[model samples]
Target chain A: MQYIHPKAIKVWRIHGMISAAISFVLFLVLMLLGLFLFRWLLYLAAGFLVIGLVDFLIFVSVIPILRWRFFRYRINETHVVIRDGIWFVKHTVIPMARIQFVEAEQGPLLRAYRLAKLKISTATSTHHIPALSIGQAQKLRDRLAAFIQASDVDV
Target chain B: MKRAHPLSIFAGFFKELKQLLLPIIIGALFGIRHDDGMSEWFALFGIGICLFFAVIEWWRTRYQVLEDQLYVKIGTIFMKERFIRFERIQSLHLSTNPFLKLFGLVRLEVHTAGGEDKAEFALPAVKRDEALRLQERIGGSNRSSQEDLLAVLDRSENSERVYRLRGGELVLAALTSSGARVIFLGLFTLLGQIGELWDRVSFITPLRREFHRVIGVPLLEAAAGVAAVLLIFWLLSSAIAFVKMYRFTLTVREKDWVIRRGFFEQTEQIVPFKRVQAVKIRENWLKQSFGYASVYLDVAGGQAGDGASEVLLYPLIRKERVAEFLAAIRSPFPWAVPTAAVSIRAFYWKIIKYVVPLAVLATILSLWVPYGAWSWLLVAASMALSWLGYRDASFAVDGDRVALGRREFSKETILTERKRLQFLSCRVSPVQKRLKLMTVQSGLIAGNNGYSFRICDLPLAEGRRLYEWYITAYTRSARRELQRVDGESSYSL
Candidate 1:
C-alpha cells in the first residue's frame, strides 16, 4: 500500500471551501427570489457550513485510513496496474501504448506543501492520482516516460 | 496584423437586434395589454444591454497573428484569448457579401479538426487583399508541412498526382442530378408563404379590422394581397437557392480535397485525404432514374449541423464519374458493384419493429378520435416504407474495404477500410444472446468527428474475426507487442 502525502488534506479543504462559497451565493440568490423563508435560508446556510466542515474533517481525518488502503503503481512490461478503492476494490490496468500524455498539476495549496497530482491522459479518458510528494511524482513521470519510449522501440 | 473591419460590429449589432426585435416587440405588446411596468422596463433594459454589447464589440474586437499562431482577443469583462496553432489549421476560408464587397472586405475563417463550435476561428471582416495574402501564407506553410510529412512517409510522388474537376464537369454534374430537390425546396417555401399569409388575413380578425378602419378599404383588397405575397416568396426562394449553391466546385489537391461552394458567402473546406474515414456513394430511386449518384464523405472533422459527422462531397454527380473521382483520391472501393441484398429475415424484423408503434397509434385514434380508420393509412404507409428499407439494406466486401447500402427517406451507401478503424467492440444484448447473435461496432476516432462506420448485428464468430482483423491490420506499430506468457512452459516449448 502506498500512502498519499498528508498535504492532500489542504487541497481537499480548499476545494471544499470554493464549493461551499458557490453554494452560499446560490442560496442567497434563492432567498432573494423568495423561494425559502428566512429561517429556512438560515438552516440552508448552516447545512452548507456543516457540509464544508465535514469535508475538511474528512480530508484531515480520512487520509491515514486511505493511505493504509491504497497502493502505488509502477509500470510493468505490458501494462500499468493501479490497485486502490476502499470499500469496493478496483484494479485498473492500462496498456503503456495507450497513454497520450502525462501531466503533474500543482495548486497553490499543494505547491505550499510540496505535493502534486499525477494525471494520465489516454485517447478515451483521463485518470488522476492526487497527493503525491513532488519527488515521487517526478520519479513516476520519468519511469512511465522511459517505459513508453522503450515500448515505442519494441513496436 | 489584420484588424476586422470597423463596420462589422454595426453589422453584427444590427443582425442581432433584428433577431431579437420580434420577441421584444411581442413581449412589449403583451405587457402593454397587461399594463405591466416590469415588462416594459425589461424591454428597455434588453435594448440597452444589446446596444452596450454592440458598443463594446465595436471598440474591443481585434485579431492578430503571433509567429506560428493566430490570436483573436475579444470581450470586455470576461476577456477571452483564443489561440489557434498554424499546424493545426486545416483551412483558411474567405467569404464576402454585397455589404462587405462594397468595402472590399471578406470574412476569414480558420477551421481546425474538432467539434463544430470550436472548429472555426472567424474574423468577421478583413480587407480582401490582406485576407488573401494571409490565406496564401498560411496555406503555403501548411502545404509545405504536409509535404514534409509525406516525404517522411515516402509518398511524395503520389501526393503530386492531385485531381481537379473541370468547370464543365461540375456544371454537367449539377444539371443532370437531383438539382430538382432545390426546385422542390423552392416550392415548399412558396407553400409556406401562402400558408402564413392565409393565416394572417383569415385568422387575425383584429388586424384585418384595424387595416380596414385605417385605410377605408374593403376586405377584398386584403384578399388581393395573397397573390403579391406568393410571387415575392417564389422569387425569394429561387434567389436563395441560386445564391447559396451558385458556382459550386470541388477540387482535389495534394493530400487534401477542397470543396468551394456558395455565391454570396463563399465557403472553401480543405479536407485532408487521411482525415477521410469513409466514402459513401448513394443512389436513391429518383437519382437512379437519371443515372446520378450523390457522394457523401465521412471525414474526421465536424458534423454538417445534422448531428452526423458526414459531409456531402458532391451532393449530385454522374455515376460514371464517381469511379474516376474516387480513383483520383486512391479510395479503395469499386464505384459500381452488385451488393448482396438484405435477407427476408431482415425485412420481417423491420416490419415487426415498426408495426408495434403504428398499431398503438391506430388503436388510440380509433378509440378516442372521430377519424379512426384514417390512422390505419399511416400504418399501411409505414409498412410499405419498412419493406422498402429492408429491400434496400445490403452489405458488400470489396478487397480490404466494406460497403453498406441502406435506405430510409433516401438511399445511403457507405464504403470504409479496416485500417481506418480506431476501436472495435463486440456487444451482446439479452435478446441477441438468446439467439446467439452479437453486434460489432467499429469506431474510427480521427479527432472529435464521431464514429466513421458502424455495422450492427452479425454472428459472434464473424464479429470476433473482424475485430481480430482490425486489431492486427490497423494497430499502429508503436502500440503493437509480441505475445507474452504468464505461465505454461510446455506451451512455449
Candidate 2:
C-alpha cells in the first residue's frame, strides 16, 4: 500500500489558490456594490472575507497534508484495494480479472506537476487514483493492462 | 460476406432521415411561417444526403459467418472489418420492424463480452432461418455451463415453451405495474403540443367550466384533478402493457434461452446460460398478498439500452412455482428462509435513522399549522415500515452461493454464485463505525452497468468476516503468485 505523490499537496494548494483568487475578485465586486449600491451589503462582504481566510488556513493548508497521509492504494495479483478520504472514508476492492481497461489522463494542473490520474474501469464502475508521477502512472497502466490481458475474463 | 436484403437500403434511408428529423422539421417550420426560400431547400438537401448515405451504407455493409467467427465489414468512407469469436459472443438477439418484416428480413444483433453501451454490432437484415442457424452455431465458449443446457434440451427437445404470459396474467401484470409514469410522460408530450391538441379537444373547456362550478372549493378541485389523473393512468398503463407484453413467451433450447415478446416490431432475445450472473425475485406488498412475484435474471454482457437489462424471467408467477422457473434457467438454488427477527441494534438504529428525523419534523408541523397534527400518522407509518424492512431483510451463505433478501416498499431477493461476483465491498461511514456497524455490498456485471446487492447495518465483525470470506482465496493467491508492485512504487503514489 502507498500514498499518492507528495506533489499532490502542492497541487491541492494551487487549486486552493485559484479558488482564493476567485473569492478575492468576488469580495472586491461585493465591496464596491456595498459602497455604491447597497450600503447594508458591506456585512455580506465582510462575512465572505472572513470565510475565505478561514477556508485557506484550515482546508487549503491543513486538510491537504492530512489528506496526503490518509489516501493509500495497493494493487495485487487478484485485486486493487483503495483506502481514501479524510472525511468520508471509503475502502474499495476491484477484482483484477474484471477490469475492462486501464486509462491514464492528466488535467492542466496535473500536467504542470508532471503527474497523471489513473482510471481503472470495470464493467460497472470506474475507480480513480488521483495523482501519480507521469512515468509511474504509465508503467502501472502497462503492467495492469498486461495483467488484465493474461487473466481470464470474469465479467 | 453477404449483403442485407435490398429493402434495407430503404430502411437505411429512413434511419438516416430519422436522425436528421429535427433539422428538417425546423426547416419546414421556417418555410411555412417565414416564407424563407432556403428552408425548403435545406430540408431537401438533408433528405438528399440521407438517401445517398442510405444507399452507400447498405451497399458497403456486409456480414458473414465462417470458421466459428461472425464477421461484419462496415463504413462507406473507410472500410472497417469486425469479428467476434463464437466463444466470446455473449448473446444473440433477433428483431424485425414492420418495414423489414415486409421483406421477410430480421435484424440480428450479436453481443459479446466487454460492456460498451450496445450490442457489439447488428447485421441489419438477415432471414429468420439464417439468424437461428447463426445462433445454433455459437454453442458458447464454456463447456461447464453447457452440460445443464444440454440436459434441459434432452428433457424436452420438441417442447420449447417454458412459460407464456397469458392474456389475463398479462393484463394483471400491467395493472400492478406503476404505469402512472407513462401517462405522466404522455401528459408532458401533450403539453408540449398544447396549441394543436387543445384546439381539437375543445370539449375539455366546457368540462373545466363544469368542474369549476361544481367543485368550487380548492381542496375538492385538487381531489377531482387527482381522480382524473388516476383514471387516465389506469387506462394508459393497461394499454401500454398490453402492447409491450403481447404474447410474451419464454422459451429455452440448447445453448441459449430465447424470449420472444412485443406486439409490433417483435423482438427475440437469445441469452447464453453462462451469461447469467444472478437471479433476482421481486415482490411488492400487493403481489406478495396475491402469492405472486416477478423473477429477473441478471446476465453478464450487453449494454443496458440494448434492452439487455435484467431480463424478465416471469412477469408474475405464483411463489410456489418459482422453483420450476429456476430449474429451467440453471440448477435449482437453495432458497434461503430467514431464521429470526433482526438484530436489536439495527432495529433501534432504524428508529434513529428514519423515525426520529421524521418525528421531529412531524412535531414541528403539529405545533404550527391547522390540522397538521395528522403528520404524526405518517411518522407512525414510517416507523412501522422500517420495522418491517429490517425484520424481513436477511442473508444466508450456503456453500458457494449466497442469497440475500431485503424488503423496502417491495421485497427483493437476490441469489448469486460466489464466482460471479465482480467485487465485494463493505462500506463503513464514520457514524456507522462508531455504532460498530458496516454495510456489506457486492457487485455483479449485468445489463449496461451492473447489479449491486447491499445489506446495511451488519455488525462490524460480521461485515469483516463476509469481506474476508469473499477475498480470502484471492488474497492468498495474490500473495503467493505476485509481489510485482515493489519499492519506489510505494513512495511515488
Candidate 3:
C-alpha cells in the first residue's frame, strides 16, 4: 500500500475549510434573520452558531490529519486496489481488464500544488485517487492504459 | 423498393396531428375569445395541413429490402437515407391493439441496441403477413445456414419447446406477484368503507337489510368484505397476467431462444445466446413460502418488451426445478453448487446495522407522535429480515459460473458466467476487520444499463478468495470437467 502525496493534507484542509465557511456564513445569515425577521430562528440560529464553530475547529485541526493518515492505494498489473473512507473504510478492487477509461484532472488549487486526481472507470463503477503528484499521476495513467490491451476490455 | 401499407397514411396523419394539436387548439381558442366565426375554418385548415403533410410523407418515404440490409429513404427534398444491416438487427416486434386488429394490421419495429425508446427502424402500419415475412427475412441472418434450418426442422419442433406455463401456475404466479402494497392499501380502504357502508345503507331499504340479515355477524361481514376484495384483486391481476403471458412458451433451436405468448396481443422475442448476461431467480417472501420462484434474464441487446429491462423467462416454476429448466433450455449458466452461508455473528451485525437506527426512530416517534408506538413493529420486521439475510446471503464460484444468493425483502439468486462480469470488488469496515468479515460484489452489463450483485457478510478469507478468483484466469479451468452442465442430461419435458 502507498500513501497519497503529503500535499493532500493541505488540499484536504482547504476543502474542509471551504465547506465550514459556508456553514459559518449561513449561521451569520440565520442570526441576522432571527434578530430582525423571525422570533423562532433565534434559538435555531444560536444552535447553528455553536455547530459552525465546532465544524470550523474540527475541519482545520482534526479531520485533515486523520484522513491523510488513513488513505492508502495500490496499482498493479491485474487490478487497482484502494483503501479509503474515514469511518466505514471501504476497500475497492477494480480489475484492469474491466477498466473502461482512465482520466487525470487538476483544479487551480491542485495545479498550484503540482498535484492531480486520478480517475479510473469500469463498466459499472468509478473510483478516484485524490491528490497525487502530477508526474506520478501521468506515469500511472500511461502505464495502466498501456497495460489494458483493447482486446482485453469488455463491458 | 416499397412504401408501407395504405393504413400508414392514417397513422402518419394521426401522428402529425398529435404533435400539432396544442398549437391548433391555442389558435382556435384565441379566435373563439374574440368571437371570430372564422375559428372553425382555421381548425379545418390546420387539419388539412396535417393531412397534406401526412400524404406527402407517406408518398416520399420508401424502403428497399436488400440481400442483407434494409435501406430506408425519407423526404422528397433534403432526403435522408439509412442502411440497417440485417446482421445488426437484434430483435423484431410486431403488435396490434383492437383497432389495428380489426384492419388486420400490426406495427412492426426493428431494433438493435443502445438507444432507449427508439427502434433502429419502424413501420407504423403493415399487414400482418408482410410483417411476419419481414421478420423472417431479417431474423434468418442470425442462423442462416439452410442445413441448420433443416436440422432443426428435421427434429420435432414440439421437442424444442423448453418450457411452457401450466394452467395452474399461470394463476399462481399472478396471485404471488409483487402486488403486496396494493393488497394492504385495499384492505385499509375496505375497512374504512365498512362503517360508511353501514351508515349509508342503514336507510337505503330492503337490499341493505336483506344483505345484512344474511351475513348476520359484523365480524363475518368484515371478513366477507376482505375476502371479496382479495378475490377481486386476485382475479383482476390474474386476468392481466393471463392476457400477457397466456400460453407462454420458450423454444430453443441451436443457440437462439424464442419466446411466444399473449392472448389478445401476441408477442414473439428472439434472444441469441451471446446476448444473455445473467439469470435471476427471484423468490419473494410470499413465493418463498409457497416454494415458487420466477426466472428472469438480463439480456444485453434489443429494446425487447414494453421497454422493461429484464425479460421474463419463466414466470413461475418450482424453485427446485429451476436447474432442470435451465438444462432443458441448454443454458450456458446452470445452477449447481449450494451457496455457502454467512456465520451467525453476521446476523448480529446485520441486526445492529438495520435495527438500531430504526429502533431510535421508533423511540422518538413513540415519545412525540400519537400513533408512533406502532413504529416498533417496523423495528421487529427489520430484525427478522436481517436475520433471514444473514442466514441466506452468500456467494459461490464453480468452473466459470458465479452465483450470488441474497435476501433484501426477497431472496434473489443471480448466476452469471465469468466472461460477462464487468468487475469484482470486496469491502470491509473497522468493525468487520475485527470480526474478520467482508462483502463481495460483482457487476454485469444488463438491459437496465448495469446491475451489481452484492454478497454481504462473508468470512474475510472467503471474500478475498472470491475477489482473487475473478482475476485469476489460470485456476478457473482446473475443475472444468467436473462442471455439472458438461454432461448431456435428459429430463421429462
TM-score of each: 0.56, 0.71, 0.75
Interface RMSD, candidate 2? 10.8
The top-ranked prediction according to lDDT is 3
| TM-score of candidate 2 on Cα atoms, chains taken together | 0.71
Candidate 2 wrong stretches, greater than 4 Å: A1-7, A33-51, A103-118, A131-153, B1-93, B97-103, B108-161, B179-218, B303-306, B331-334, B337-393, B407-409, B451-454, B459-461, B477-493
Best by TM-score: 3
Order of candidate numbers by lDDT, starting with the best: 3, 2, 1
| CA lDDT, every model vs. true structure | 0.57, 0.69, 0.72
Taken in order, the candidates have interface RMSDs of 13.1, 10.8, 8.9
Give Cα distance to truth, residue A69, candidate 2, Å: 3.1
Residues A1-155, candidate 3: write the lDDT tens digits.
99999998898788777777877787888889988999788888778777777767887778888888888988876667888878777777776666777999999989989999999987567789988999999999998897566225343
User: Candidate 1 lDDT, tens digit per residue, A1-155?
Assistant: 35566567566666666765666665566556445445566666666556656654664467445744464554554455455555333334445644556788898878888998898764444557777999988888888788666544211
lDDT of 3 by residue, B1-493 (tens): 8888888888778867767865664344222333566767877898998788778777877898898999998874567898888876655666665567789887777666556646766776888778767766776885422222332223344435567788887778777775444466556655566455444432323534555799787555555655655665556566667778888888786766767677755665666666688888888787889998888888774445456667887788888898998888878688754467567878888877899999999999999975567679779989988888887777788967888788767888888877577766677878887888887777776663676768888888777777777766523242232233324311100
Docking class of 3: acceptable
How do the candidates rank by DockQ, highest first? Answer: 3, 2, 1
DockQ of every predicted complex: 0.04, 0.30, 0.35
Q: Residue B235's C-alpha lDDT in candidate 2?
A: 66
* Candidate 3 off by > 4 Å: A47-51, A150-155, B1-92, B96-104, B117-121, B128-159, B179-236, B359-377, B474-493
Candidate number with greatest DockQ: 3
Clashes of each: 0, 3, 0
lDDT digits (tens) for residues B188-259 of candidate 2: 644464445323434445655678898787555544654554566566666766776788888766656666
Give model 1's docking category: incorrect
